[model samples]
Target: MQRYFETELLDVKNFELPKEIYKHAIVVMRAKVGDHFELVTADQKVHLMEVTAITKTAATAKEIEVFEQLTELPVETTIVCGLSKGDKAEFIVQKGTELGADHFVFFKGEYSVAKWDDKKQKKKLARLEKIALAAAEQSHRTTIPTVAYLSSLQELTLAADEKGLIAYEEAAKEGEKGALVTLLKEIKVAPKETKRPKLQAIFGPEGGLAFQEVTALEERGYIRAGLGPRIMRAETAPLYLLSSLSFALELR
Candidate 1:
Protein backbone atom coordinates (compact mmCIF):
# COMPACT_ATOMS: atom_id res chain seq x y z
CA MET A 1 0.00 0.00 0.00
CA GLN A 2 1.91 3.01 -1.30
CA ARG A 3 0.81 6.28 0.22
CA TYR A 4 0.91 9.73 -1.30
CA PHE A 5 0.20 13.02 0.42
CA GLU A 6 -2.30 15.03 -1.56
CA THR A 7 -2.93 18.74 -1.20
CA GLU A 8 -6.73 18.39 -1.03
CA LEU A 9 -9.11 16.22 0.96
CA LEU A 10 -10.37 13.74 -1.63
CA ASP A 11 -13.91 12.51 -1.44
CA VAL A 12 -13.10 9.82 -3.96
CA LYS A 13 -16.73 8.82 -3.91
CA ASN A 14 -16.68 10.67 -7.24
CA PHE A 15 -13.16 11.98 -7.58
CA GLU A 16 -10.48 12.47 -10.15
CA LEU A 17 -6.75 12.45 -9.64
CA PRO A 18 -4.98 15.59 -10.74
CA LYS A 19 -2.88 15.42 -13.91
CA GLU A 20 0.33 14.69 -12.02
CA ILE A 21 -1.30 12.06 -9.84
CA TYR A 22 -3.03 10.52 -12.85
CA LYS A 23 0.24 10.01 -14.65
CA HIS A 24 1.78 8.43 -11.58
CA ALA A 25 -1.13 6.03 -11.18
CA ILE A 26 -1.78 5.13 -14.79
CA VAL A 27 1.70 5.23 -16.25
CA VAL A 28 4.12 4.99 -13.39
CA MET A 29 2.27 2.45 -11.29
CA ARG A 30 0.61 0.91 -14.34
CA ALA A 31 -2.65 0.97 -12.44
CA LYS A 32 -5.78 0.54 -14.55
CA VAL A 33 -9.47 0.89 -13.94
CA GLY A 34 -10.54 -1.30 -10.99
CA ASP A 35 -7.09 -1.23 -9.46
CA HIS A 36 -6.98 -0.18 -5.83
CA PHE A 37 -4.43 1.84 -3.91
CA GLU A 38 -4.16 3.63 -0.60
CA LEU A 39 -4.60 7.38 -0.75
CA VAL A 40 -3.85 9.87 1.98
CA THR A 41 -5.72 13.15 1.70
CA ALA A 42 -4.57 16.58 2.77
CA ASP A 43 -6.39 16.11 6.08
CA GLN A 44 -4.19 13.04 6.69
CA LYS A 45 -7.07 10.59 6.30
CA VAL A 46 -6.18 7.29 4.65
CA HIS A 47 -8.60 5.66 2.25
CA LEU A 48 -8.80 2.78 -0.19
CA MET A 49 -9.75 4.08 -3.59
CA GLU A 50 -10.21 2.20 -6.88
CA VAL A 51 -9.41 3.63 -10.24
CA THR A 52 -12.54 4.16 -12.28
CA ALA A 53 -11.37 6.07 -15.33
CA ILE A 54 -8.00 6.99 -16.76
CA THR A 55 -7.73 10.08 -18.90
CA LYS A 56 -4.97 11.98 -20.66
CA THR A 57 -4.97 14.71 -18.05
CA ALA A 58 -6.31 12.85 -15.02
CA ALA A 59 -7.53 9.63 -13.48
CA THR A 60 -10.70 9.10 -11.45
CA ALA A 61 -11.07 6.93 -8.41
CA LYS A 62 -14.07 5.83 -6.39
CA GLU A 63 -13.70 5.71 -2.67
CA ILE A 64 -14.27 2.17 -1.51
CA GLU A 65 -13.20 2.12 2.14
CA VAL A 66 -11.35 4.17 4.70
CA PHE A 67 -9.32 3.44 7.82
CA GLU A 68 -9.12 6.12 10.48
CA GLN A 69 -5.72 5.61 11.96
CA LEU A 70 -3.48 8.16 13.62
CA THR A 71 0.31 7.65 13.54
CA GLU A 72 2.00 10.62 15.16
CA LEU A 73 4.44 11.18 17.98
CA PRO A 74 3.07 11.60 21.48
CA VAL A 75 5.14 14.75 21.91
CA GLU A 76 6.02 17.23 19.20
CA THR A 77 9.82 17.62 19.10
CA THR A 78 11.66 20.16 16.96
CA ILE A 79 15.38 19.65 16.25
CA VAL A 80 17.43 22.81 15.81
CA CYS A 81 20.92 22.10 14.50
CA GLY A 82 23.76 24.38 13.53
CA LEU A 83 24.56 24.39 9.82
CA SER A 84 27.16 21.74 8.92
CA LYS A 85 29.32 21.29 5.83
CA GLY A 86 28.27 19.79 2.47
CA ASP A 87 25.25 17.45 2.29
CA LYS A 88 25.19 16.70 6.00
CA ALA A 89 22.26 19.08 6.47
CA GLU A 90 20.27 17.20 3.85
CA PHE A 91 21.09 13.92 5.55
CA ILE A 92 19.85 15.36 8.82
CA VAL A 93 16.55 16.40 7.30
CA GLN A 94 15.94 12.99 5.68
CA LYS A 95 16.88 10.86 8.66
CA GLY A 96 15.32 13.27 11.10
CA THR A 97 12.00 13.01 9.29
CA GLU A 98 12.07 9.20 9.55
CA LEU A 99 12.95 9.53 13.23
CA GLY A 100 9.74 11.61 13.81
CA ALA A 101 11.08 15.14 14.01
CA ASP A 102 8.15 17.55 13.88
CA HIS A 103 10.22 20.46 12.62
CA PHE A 104 13.83 21.48 11.92
CA VAL A 105 15.70 24.78 12.18
CA PHE A 106 19.19 25.36 10.81
CA PHE A 107 21.15 28.16 12.40
CA LYS A 108 24.47 29.63 11.32
CA GLY A 109 26.86 29.42 14.20
CA GLU A 110 30.38 30.65 14.99
CA TYR A 111 31.87 27.20 14.32
CA SER A 112 29.76 26.50 11.23
CA VAL A 113 31.82 25.85 8.10
CA ALA A 114 29.11 26.17 5.48
CA LYS A 115 27.90 29.58 4.37
CA TRP A 116 24.71 30.09 2.39
CA ASP A 117 23.93 33.10 0.17
CA ASP A 118 20.33 34.04 -0.69
CA LYS A 119 20.06 31.89 -3.85
CA LYS A 120 22.02 28.99 -2.36
CA GLN A 121 19.93 29.13 0.77
CA LYS A 122 16.68 28.90 -1.18
CA LYS A 123 17.92 25.97 -3.24
CA LYS A 124 19.19 24.12 -0.18
CA LEU A 125 15.92 24.64 1.71
CA ALA A 126 13.88 23.39 -1.24
CA ARG A 127 16.05 20.28 -1.55
CA LEU A 128 15.72 19.56 2.15
CA GLU A 129 11.93 19.90 1.93
CA LYS A 130 11.73 17.38 -0.91
CA ILE A 131 13.82 14.89 1.04
CA ALA A 132 11.63 15.35 4.11
CA LEU A 133 8.40 14.75 2.17
CA ALA A 134 9.72 11.58 0.59
CA ALA A 135 10.90 10.28 3.94
CA ALA A 136 7.53 11.13 5.53
CA GLU A 137 5.61 9.16 2.92
CA GLN A 138 7.96 6.20 3.21
CA SER A 139 7.69 6.17 6.99
CA HIS A 140 3.85 6.37 6.94
CA ARG A 141 3.91 9.79 8.55
CA THR A 142 0.73 11.82 8.16
CA THR A 143 2.45 15.17 8.24
CA ILE A 144 5.72 16.24 6.66
CA PRO A 145 8.32 17.93 8.81
CA THR A 146 9.20 21.58 8.08
CA VAL A 147 12.74 22.75 7.20
CA ALA A 148 13.60 26.37 7.94
CA TYR A 149 16.35 28.48 6.45
CA LEU A 150 19.50 29.25 8.38
CA SER A 151 19.11 31.78 11.18
CA SER A 152 21.35 33.44 13.71
CA LEU A 153 21.83 32.19 17.27
CA GLN A 154 20.08 35.27 18.63
CA GLU A 155 17.11 34.75 16.31
CA LEU A 156 16.86 31.05 17.17
CA THR A 157 17.09 31.57 20.92
CA LEU A 158 14.44 34.32 20.82
CA ALA A 159 12.02 31.93 19.07
CA ALA A 160 12.69 28.97 21.35
CA ASP A 161 10.30 27.92 24.07
CA GLU A 162 11.00 27.07 27.71
CA LYS A 163 11.03 23.28 27.13
CA GLY A 164 14.15 23.13 24.95
CA LEU A 165 17.53 21.44 25.49
CA ILE A 166 20.87 22.06 23.83
CA ALA A 167 23.37 19.21 23.54
CA TYR A 168 26.80 20.40 24.62
CA GLU A 169 29.66 17.94 25.28
CA GLU A 170 30.96 20.10 28.11
CA ALA A 171 27.76 19.50 30.05
CA ALA A 172 28.69 15.84 30.51
CA LYS A 173 32.21 16.81 31.61
CA GLU A 174 30.56 18.85 34.33
CA GLY A 175 28.89 15.60 35.61
CA GLU A 176 25.54 16.20 33.88
CA LYS A 177 23.77 13.21 32.40
CA GLY A 178 23.19 12.87 28.65
CA ALA A 179 20.53 15.12 27.15
CA LEU A 180 18.51 12.18 25.83
CA VAL A 181 18.54 10.53 29.22
CA THR A 182 17.47 13.74 30.93
CA LEU A 183 14.63 14.27 28.50
CA LEU A 184 13.42 10.70 28.95
CA LYS A 185 13.44 11.05 32.70
CA GLU A 186 11.40 14.23 32.46
CA ILE A 187 8.86 12.62 30.17
CA LYS A 188 8.54 9.61 32.44
CA VAL A 189 7.85 11.81 35.46
CA ALA A 190 5.23 13.88 33.64
CA PRO A 191 1.59 13.22 34.51
CA LYS A 192 -0.01 10.87 32.03
CA GLU A 193 -3.21 12.92 31.90
CA THR A 194 -1.32 16.08 31.09
CA LYS A 195 -0.49 17.01 27.52
CA ARG A 196 3.06 16.05 26.54
CA PRO A 197 5.56 18.88 26.52
CA LYS A 198 7.18 20.10 23.33
CA LEU A 199 10.92 19.32 23.44
CA GLN A 200 13.32 21.16 21.16
CA ALA A 201 16.80 19.59 20.94
CA ILE A 202 19.59 21.76 19.51
CA PHE A 203 22.89 20.42 18.11
CA GLY A 204 26.01 22.16 16.93
CA PRO A 205 28.03 21.70 13.73
CA GLU A 206 31.26 19.79 13.00
CA GLY A 207 33.47 22.01 15.08
CA GLY A 208 30.66 22.16 17.64
CA LEU A 209 29.23 25.25 19.34
CA ALA A 210 31.57 28.02 20.41
CA PHE A 211 31.89 28.71 24.12
CA GLN A 212 30.03 31.99 23.72
CA GLU A 213 27.21 30.36 21.73
CA VAL A 214 26.80 27.70 24.40
CA THR A 215 26.80 30.41 27.09
CA ALA A 216 24.24 32.39 25.12
CA LEU A 217 21.94 29.37 24.86
CA GLU A 218 22.23 28.79 28.60
CA GLU A 219 21.28 32.38 29.31
CA ARG A 220 18.23 31.97 27.08
CA GLY A 221 16.94 29.18 29.35
CA TYR A 222 18.24 26.22 27.33
CA ILE A 223 19.56 23.43 29.56
CA ARG A 224 22.87 22.16 28.23
CA ALA A 225 23.07 18.33 28.31
CA GLY A 226 25.48 15.91 26.68
CA LEU A 227 24.89 12.79 24.60
CA GLY A 228 27.73 10.46 25.60
CA PRO A 229 31.46 10.12 26.17
CA ARG A 230 32.03 9.54 22.49
CA ILE A 231 31.26 12.61 20.40
CA MET A 232 28.89 12.07 17.48
CA ARG A 233 29.19 13.74 14.11
CA ALA A 234 27.20 16.86 13.35
CA GLU A 235 24.66 15.01 11.18
CA THR A 236 24.53 11.86 13.31
CA ALA A 237 23.75 13.56 16.61
CA PRO A 238 20.29 14.86 15.66
CA LEU A 239 19.14 11.48 14.31
CA TYR A 240 20.21 9.83 17.52
CA LEU A 241 18.44 12.50 19.54
CA LEU A 242 15.22 12.24 17.57
CA SER A 243 15.20 8.43 17.60
CA SER A 244 15.71 8.43 21.34
CA LEU A 245 12.83 10.90 21.75
CA SER A 246 10.49 8.77 19.62
CA PHE A 247 11.41 5.67 21.57
CA ALA A 248 10.85 7.42 24.87
CA LEU A 249 7.61 9.20 23.99
CA GLU A 250 5.95 7.02 21.36
CA LEU A 251 7.30 3.51 21.91
CA ARG A 252 7.23 3.64 25.69
Candidate 2:
Protein backbone atom coordinates (compact mmCIF):
# COMPACT_ATOMS: atom_id res chain seq x y z
CA MET A 1 0.00 0.00 0.00
CA GLN A 2 1.13 3.56 -0.62
CA ARG A 3 1.77 5.98 2.27
CA TYR A 4 1.17 9.69 2.76
CA PHE A 5 1.29 12.24 5.55
CA GLU A 6 -1.77 13.91 7.07
CA THR A 7 -0.87 17.29 8.46
CA GLU A 8 -4.03 17.83 10.52
CA LEU A 9 -4.78 14.81 12.65
CA LEU A 10 -8.42 14.16 13.25
CA ASP A 11 -10.32 12.76 16.21
CA VAL A 12 -12.94 11.17 13.99
CA LYS A 13 -12.46 7.61 12.88
CA ASN A 14 -13.29 8.63 9.30
CA PHE A 15 -11.48 11.69 8.06
CA GLU A 16 -11.31 13.86 4.98
CA LEU A 17 -8.16 14.21 2.94
CA PRO A 18 -6.49 17.58 2.47
CA LYS A 19 -6.46 19.28 -0.88
CA GLU A 20 -2.92 18.29 -1.86
CA ILE A 21 -3.31 14.72 -0.68
CA TYR A 22 -6.70 14.56 -2.37
CA LYS A 23 -5.14 15.64 -5.62
CA HIS A 24 -2.45 13.01 -5.32
CA ALA A 25 -4.66 10.11 -4.31
CA ILE A 26 -7.93 10.89 -6.04
CA VAL A 27 -6.64 12.73 -9.06
CA VAL A 28 -3.07 11.65 -9.58
CA MET A 29 -3.02 8.09 -8.28
CA ARG A 30 -6.61 7.55 -9.44
CA ALA A 31 -7.34 5.63 -6.29
CA LYS A 32 -10.82 4.14 -6.11
CA VAL A 33 -13.16 3.81 -3.17
CA GLY A 34 -11.96 0.35 -2.11
CA ASP A 35 -8.27 1.05 -2.30
CA HIS A 36 -6.09 1.30 0.79
CA PHE A 37 -3.00 3.23 1.80
CA GLU A 38 -1.04 4.03 4.94
CA LEU A 39 -1.51 7.38 6.58
CA VAL A 40 0.76 9.11 9.08
CA THR A 41 -1.05 11.71 11.11
CA ALA A 42 0.19 14.72 13.04
CA ASP A 43 0.37 12.65 16.24
CA GLN A 44 2.87 10.36 14.49
CA LYS A 45 0.49 7.44 14.56
CA VAL A 46 0.38 5.16 11.56
CA HIS A 47 -3.05 4.21 10.27
CA LEU A 48 -3.89 1.66 7.64
CA MET A 49 -6.66 3.48 5.86
CA GLU A 50 -9.24 2.36 3.31
CA VAL A 51 -10.98 4.77 1.09
CA THR A 52 -14.68 4.82 2.00
CA ALA A 53 -16.17 7.73 0.13
CA ILE A 54 -15.33 10.31 -2.49
CA THR A 55 -16.90 13.64 -3.35
CA LYS A 56 -16.22 16.12 -6.12
CA THR A 57 -13.62 18.04 -4.18
CA ALA A 58 -12.42 15.61 -1.50
CA ALA A 59 -12.09 11.98 -0.49
CA THR A 60 -12.47 10.19 2.84
CA ALA A 61 -10.66 7.30 4.38
CA LYS A 62 -11.72 5.09 7.26
CA GLU A 63 -9.10 4.07 9.73
CA ILE A 64 -8.86 0.32 9.33
CA GLU A 65 -6.12 -0.28 11.85
CA VAL A 66 -3.93 1.71 14.20
CA PHE A 67 -0.41 0.47 14.27
CA GLU A 68 1.86 0.85 17.26
CA GLN A 69 4.66 -0.65 15.25
CA LEU A 70 8.03 0.95 15.79
CA THR A 71 9.55 2.48 12.65
CA GLU A 72 11.95 4.98 14.20
CA LEU A 73 15.36 4.74 15.75
CA PRO A 74 15.33 4.09 19.46
CA VAL A 75 17.43 7.18 20.00
CA GLU A 76 16.70 10.51 18.37
CA THR A 77 19.43 11.40 15.84
CA THR A 78 20.29 14.78 14.37
CA ILE A 79 22.82 14.94 11.53
CA VAL A 80 24.68 18.24 11.38
CA CYS A 81 26.81 19.19 8.38
CA GLY A 82 28.72 22.23 7.26
CA LEU A 83 26.84 23.85 4.38
CA SER A 84 28.21 22.62 1.08
CA LYS A 85 27.72 23.83 -2.46
CA GLY A 86 25.33 22.44 -5.11
CA ASP A 87 22.80 19.70 -4.29
CA LYS A 88 24.62 18.06 -1.39
CA ALA A 89 22.29 19.38 1.29
CA GLU A 90 19.25 18.05 -0.54
CA PHE A 91 20.93 14.68 -0.92
CA ILE A 92 21.70 14.58 2.79
CA VAL A 93 18.11 15.29 3.79
CA GLN A 94 16.67 12.93 1.18
CA LYS A 95 18.88 9.93 1.80
CA GLY A 96 19.37 10.71 5.48
CA THR A 97 15.63 10.46 6.12
CA GLU A 98 15.56 7.04 4.49
CA LEU A 99 18.39 5.98 6.81
CA GLY A 100 16.50 7.09 9.95
CA ALA A 101 17.78 10.58 10.63
CA ASP A 102 15.32 12.46 12.85
CA HIS A 103 16.66 15.91 12.11
CA PHE A 104 19.27 17.73 10.00
CA VAL A 105 21.23 20.91 10.62
CA PHE A 106 23.33 22.88 8.16
CA PHE A 107 25.71 25.59 9.25
CA LYS A 108 28.28 27.91 7.78
CA GLY A 109 31.70 26.44 8.33
CA GLU A 110 34.95 28.36 8.58
CA TYR A 111 35.89 26.96 5.18
CA SER A 112 32.43 26.72 3.68
CA VAL A 113 32.46 27.09 -0.08
CA ALA A 114 28.78 27.97 -0.41
CA LYS A 115 26.82 30.74 1.23
CA TRP A 116 23.08 31.01 1.92
CA ASP A 117 21.81 34.52 2.43
CA ASP A 118 18.60 35.18 4.38
CA LYS A 119 16.36 34.84 1.32
CA LYS A 120 18.25 31.87 0.00
CA GLN A 121 18.08 30.17 3.37
CA LYS A 122 14.31 30.51 3.46
CA LYS A 123 13.88 29.20 -0.07
CA LYS A 124 16.37 26.38 0.30
CA LEU A 125 15.02 25.34 3.67
CA ALA A 126 11.51 25.18 2.26
CA ARG A 127 12.71 22.96 -0.57
CA LEU A 128 14.66 20.74 1.79
CA GLU A 129 11.67 20.42 4.11
CA LYS A 130 9.61 19.14 1.19
CA ILE A 131 12.36 16.67 0.36
CA ALA A 132 12.35 15.42 3.93
CA LEU A 133 8.60 15.05 3.97
CA ALA A 134 8.50 13.15 0.70
CA ALA A 135 11.40 10.95 1.72
CA ALA A 136 9.74 10.14 5.02
CA GLU A 137 6.57 9.05 3.29
CA GLN A 138 8.45 7.02 0.69
CA SER A 139 10.55 5.37 3.40
CA HIS A 140 7.41 4.48 5.40
CA ARG A 141 8.60 6.53 8.35
CA THR A 142 6.14 7.48 11.08
CA THR A 143 7.82 10.79 11.70
CA ILE A 144 9.07 13.37 9.22
CA PRO A 145 12.58 14.63 9.71
CA THR A 146 13.22 18.37 10.00
CA VAL A 147 15.77 20.56 8.21
CA ALA A 148 17.36 23.64 9.77
CA TYR A 149 20.14 26.11 9.02
CA LEU A 150 22.58 28.07 11.18
CA SER A 151 24.64 31.09 10.29
CA SER A 152 27.80 29.86 11.99
CA LEU A 153 29.14 27.15 14.27
CA GLN A 154 28.54 29.39 17.27
CA GLU A 155 24.82 29.22 16.66
CA LEU A 156 24.76 25.46 17.11
CA THR A 157 23.58 24.63 20.60
CA LEU A 158 23.07 21.39 22.48
CA ALA A 159 21.15 20.38 25.54
CA ALA A 160 23.27 19.50 28.52
CA ASP A 161 22.31 15.86 28.33
CA GLU A 162 22.36 15.47 24.56
CA LYS A 163 25.28 13.42 23.27
CA GLY A 164 27.13 15.30 20.51
CA LEU A 165 29.82 13.96 18.23
CA ILE A 166 31.97 15.75 15.69
CA ALA A 167 33.26 13.59 12.85
CA TYR A 168 36.92 14.48 12.71
CA GLU A 169 38.96 12.98 9.88
CA GLU A 170 42.12 13.65 11.87
CA ALA A 171 40.85 11.33 14.56
CA ALA A 172 40.49 8.61 11.95
CA LYS A 173 44.08 9.10 10.78
CA GLU A 174 45.44 8.94 14.33
CA GLY A 175 43.96 5.42 14.69
CA GLU A 176 41.21 6.78 16.93
CA LYS A 177 38.36 4.42 16.24
CA GLY A 178 36.80 3.63 19.61
CA ALA A 179 35.15 6.97 20.41
CA LEU A 180 32.04 6.37 18.30
CA VAL A 181 31.54 2.90 19.71
CA THR A 182 32.04 4.16 23.22
CA LEU A 183 29.58 6.98 22.79
CA LEU A 184 26.98 4.67 21.28
CA LYS A 185 27.24 2.36 24.28
CA GLU A 186 27.22 5.23 26.76
CA ILE A 187 24.16 7.01 25.38
CA LYS A 188 22.00 4.07 26.36
CA VAL A 189 22.81 4.99 29.95
CA ALA A 190 22.75 8.74 29.51
CA PRO A 191 21.19 10.79 32.30
CA LYS A 192 17.61 9.73 32.88
CA GLU A 193 16.60 13.36 33.23
CA THR A 194 16.90 13.74 29.48
CA LYS A 195 13.32 14.01 28.20
CA ARG A 196 14.17 13.08 24.63
CA PRO A 197 17.40 11.16 24.33
CA LYS A 198 19.32 12.73 21.44
CA LEU A 199 22.49 11.95 19.50
CA GLN A 200 23.71 14.66 17.12
CA ALA A 201 26.74 14.12 14.90
CA ILE A 202 28.52 16.96 13.11
CA PHE A 203 30.32 16.68 9.77
CA GLY A 204 32.40 19.19 7.90
CA PRO A 205 32.08 20.45 4.35
CA GLU A 206 34.32 19.60 1.37
CA GLY A 207 37.10 21.56 3.02
CA GLY A 208 36.50 19.85 6.39
CA LEU A 209 36.01 21.39 9.78
CA ALA A 210 38.59 23.88 10.95
CA PHE A 211 40.83 22.82 13.83
CA GLN A 212 39.62 25.68 16.00
CA GLU A 213 35.97 24.76 15.40
CA VAL A 214 36.67 21.19 16.46
CA THR A 215 38.38 22.44 19.61
CA ALA A 216 35.44 24.67 20.48
CA LEU A 217 32.94 21.84 20.01
CA GLU A 218 35.09 19.59 22.18
CA GLU A 219 35.10 22.24 24.93
CA ARG A 220 31.28 22.14 24.79
CA GLY A 221 31.39 18.40 25.58
CA TYR A 222 31.16 17.14 22.02
CA ILE A 223 33.33 14.08 21.45
CA ARG A 224 35.56 13.91 18.42
CA ALA A 225 34.96 10.52 16.85
CA GLY A 226 36.44 8.69 13.91
CA LEU A 227 34.28 6.70 11.52
CA GLY A 228 36.64 3.83 10.85
CA PRO A 229 40.01 4.33 9.17
CA ARG A 230 39.00 5.83 5.85
CA ILE A 231 37.99 9.46 5.44
CA MET A 232 34.48 9.94 4.06
CA ARG A 233 33.07 12.92 2.21
CA ALA A 234 31.05 15.35 4.34
CA GLU A 235 27.76 13.86 3.14
CA THR A 236 28.97 10.28 3.52
CA ALA A 237 30.08 10.62 7.15
CA PRO A 238 26.60 11.30 8.58
CA LEU A 239 25.16 8.29 6.75
CA TYR A 240 27.97 6.17 8.18
CA LEU A 241 27.09 7.35 11.68
CA LEU A 242 23.41 6.49 11.19
CA SER A 243 24.25 3.06 9.80
CA SER A 244 26.54 2.34 12.72
CA LEU A 245 23.87 3.45 15.16
CA SER A 246 21.31 1.13 13.56
CA PHE A 247 23.65 -1.81 13.66
CA ALA A 248 24.57 -1.27 17.31
CA LEU A 249 21.11 -0.34 18.58
CA GLU A 250 18.70 -2.15 16.28
CA LEU A 251 20.59 -5.27 15.33
CA ARG A 252 22.25 -6.02 18.61
lDDT tens digits, residue span 1-252, model 2 = 688988665754678888988998899899999899888877788888888899889898888888765778878999999998889999999999999999999999998999999999999999999999989988899899999998888877788668899999999999998999888888666665535578889999989999999999998889899899887888888889998888988895
Distance from true location, Cα of 109 in model 1, Å: 1.0
Q: After superposition, how far is residue 173 of candidate 1 from its true place, in Å?
A: 4.5
Best by TM-score: 2
Total colliding residue pairs, candidate 2: 0
Q: Mark the 10 consecutive residues where model 2 has the least summed lDDT.
A: 187-196
* Candidate 2: residue 164 lDDT (0-100): 90
> If scored against the real structure, what TM-score would every candidate get?
0.89, 0.94
> In lDDT terms, how accurate is model 2?
0.88
Worst 10 residues of 1 by lDDT: 155-164
Q: CA lDDT of 25 in candidate 1?
A: 72
After superposition, the stretches of candidate 1 with alpha carbons farther than 4 Å from their true spots are 158-162, 173-175, 189-196
lDDT of 1 by residue, 153-233 (tens): 887654433377888867766767666676678766777744446777889888898999988878887888877677788
Off by more than 4 A, model 2: 11-13, 189-196
lDDT values, one for every candidate = 0.79, 0.88
